[model samples]
Target: MSEPRLSSLRWRVTVRRHPSAFLLAVQLLSLVLYPLFDEMRGGRVVFGAFGVLALALAVWVVNRSPAIKWIAWLLAVPAFGFSLLSVLFASESLLVLSSALEAAVYFYAAGSLIAYMMSDHRVTSDELFAAGATFTLLAWGFAYVFVVCQAWYPGSFTGALNPGQPRSWLELLSLSFTNLSAVGLGDVIPLGSTARVLVMLEQLAGVGYLAAVVSRLIGLTLLRHERR
Candidate 1:
């Protein structure tokens, strides 16, 4: 076979065999790339592009109904497009709106993937990948919400996050996962009632998700072992 044909075959096989893993890898790569790009000029533009790419991959990975896929595109395209436009136009309102939309998209995607993963009786590597990817998406979804809150009501967070500059996506991401893990490090503190409420809700969600999903996955794994 020709090189192009071989590459095409590999792509098809990968998408068929490990779509969840591919999505997980891309999501992780995007997180790493976001922080690195922050140091450069036009970084937000690059970041927004990656966000769109990740959103597309997420839609593909979920492999939901046509209507659902269309809905994902509707939310994700404007979220990423308006984000890039906000950076260019220096519109804080647009940025906040875009962040909210992005959060909504990720939340939907994460919920869908989690449901799909948990629906299965047997545990597989793809299921494991989907589980991790869902967690990452949840973190990102909350991070975007945090960004929106911070943008809408400046000083929502009191420490480490500077009001003068946009919060670092990476730092917000860290805070999100920390909150999800219920670590509650004091370095970044939520000041406003709204912020506090949001934090509490996220913590609750994280704990609930772990208790339900992790336990289910473990149970399935044990059952598979018994059957074997």
Candidate 2:
């Protein structure tokens, strides 16, 4: 085999071995890139390309998971397609629809990760990575929910940076992180009844996720160490 073939083979092996890790890395990388892209002209095109890549990686990760893989692809294909269409046509309705679908895809992926983690007894490296990936997935899911809510109810969210104005994607994401983590540290505040209700649900989800998933992982790790 040639050098390019060897490199490609290695990459494929790594992805198969630890697909969740790659998904987690892309999610984390987006945290840095999203804001930078927002500052650039024609950044929506770049953002759309990156989102497609992420969704493709997500579909791959879901395929390796315990959950039904085809469902994720079903949701993801239209989600990213709407996203791409929104970018190209600059249609607000398409953007909202895409966000809603993206949220569903993220939440489904998160649930898939939870199933993957719980299906086995041994604490493997991939399961560990899935834990983090699941958290980010939930956060992204709720952020997109916020996006849709803001569209439905204008002035639903306000931030220190731009009071009374519509929140940006980054700001909504920040709010999602803070609410999901139960930190309440973000400057973005959800004011409308719909937004507040969503925040409350996310808060409960954060606590429940930590209590259920993280606790189980730690307990299993400890039990394994003790048995050794």
Candidate 3:
């Protein structure tokens, strides 16, 4: 009844009504912020925090069974903690493990969201947002994969702005999205066999995903029209 209570109630309603929009906003913001900061110490911390928030929002937005929900929470909490610890200690092993876990979380969450959207007979704006979010998350996941590979084998990627230096996450992210979109600008080149294989796989995936999503959206639109 009070003003504060009213504000809290309104906030809760908005979240409940537009969870996908909120998740998409967080995904976009992280995509921007994660690349902007360059300081190693602070950058990792910010990245860790962003990972936690993004995964949390993703899990919340997707509709899941109780068992799947529990599993998501189980994986997400430890992934977040490990990420923070890896940053704090500056441990390469821990960071690699954290990146693996984070990648798993995002992959699972994105798959679940996509599955949900596909299963639903009626499509909404939220479904469209979820699709975009899933695509972006996939890019982020692969970027971390590139990071891990680079860590394991130095000089895995070349042609970055700082040539001959270890590539930053931001640079990798830029490369990942560019590769995922099949832009192939050639500014960033993957040198190692492993890196090249990963890039090729990502390019195939990007093309396949676009095809699938476009087909599904069109099918859904046709179905809606037929029902009228």
Candidate 4:
């Protein structure tokens, strides 16, 4: 009876793996899918709904997958806030808001999934590598939008983009990512007080969340090696 019960659990895990992999692929696709958005209104709607959906699915997966708890699935809070802001503002604010929130989701989601893959030795190196590659692509895409925002509409870009000062294009993209990761590098000055506060919050979330991910991975490695 015990053997059969264990087999059932194993089979369930095997079945879920494929679906989980597919979800991860689609979630990654949604990142670039935003830039291709038909129009501003449509983009905002798609971005908000898709982001919210991804986080919702993440909530489910993180709860069931004990391996990812290290990344503290609770970090999805900021990502959720970004989506809400995008839906509410749904104007010039939507681009910055949606981008930031999506970045947060991918960061946490990808990081948590990495921890999950690492802990589950059954997961293939190829699959894990593919996940990492996809994440890098997502990161670069966000970084690109941040750049183009400042480039095409220097006076028009909203949110973290400073309308007042003459910051370099690299500086602006860096700021976007810094804000996306919630990392506030003091060297690049904030255009407004609100942007400053937001930057601080982003930096906290970014560093704290990544720390959680790394800590989990290291702990698991230690345990695995110790047994060996």
TM-score of each: 0.90, 0.92, 0.90, 0.44
Instruction: Itemize residue pairs with steric clashes in candidate 3.
Output: none
Which lDDT tens digits does candidate 2 get at residues 135-226? 99899889889999999999899989869789888888888998999876979998999999999999999999999998999999999999
Would you give me the overall lDDT of model 1?
0.79
Write the number of the candidate with greater TM-score, choosing between 1 and 4.
1
lDDT of 2 at 149: 99
lDDT score, candidate 4: 0.50
Instruction: Compose the digit string of candidate 3's lDDT tens values, residues 128-185.
Output: 7777877887888788788889988899998747789887777788899999988776
* lDDT on C-alpha atoms for all candidate structures: 0.79, 0.83, 0.78, 0.50
> Could you give candidate 4's per-residue lDDT for residues 1-228 as a string of tens digits?
699999999866753554345455655576456556634554544554555465546435544755444343444455456556656676546545555555555555555555555566443433444344334424433543443344444543343455365444345445655565554453454444444554555556456545754444456567777888
Clashes of each: 0, 0, 0, 3
Q: Which runs in model 2 stand beyond 4 Å of their true positions? A: 40-49, 59-67
Candidate with more favorable, higher lDDT: 3 or 4: 3
Candidate 1 local lDDT, 1-228, one digit each (tens):
999999999998877677678777887887777777777655754565576567666666567588878888888888888888887887878877888988998898888788777786878888888888888888888988999888877777765546556456666777898999888774677778888999999999999989999778988889888888
**Candidates by TM-score, descending order:** 2, 1, 3, 4
Top candidate, metric lDDT: 2
Query: Comparing candidate 2 with candidate 3, which one achieves the higher lDDT?
Result: 2
Which residues of candidate 3, in runs, are more than 4 Å off?
Answer: 222-228
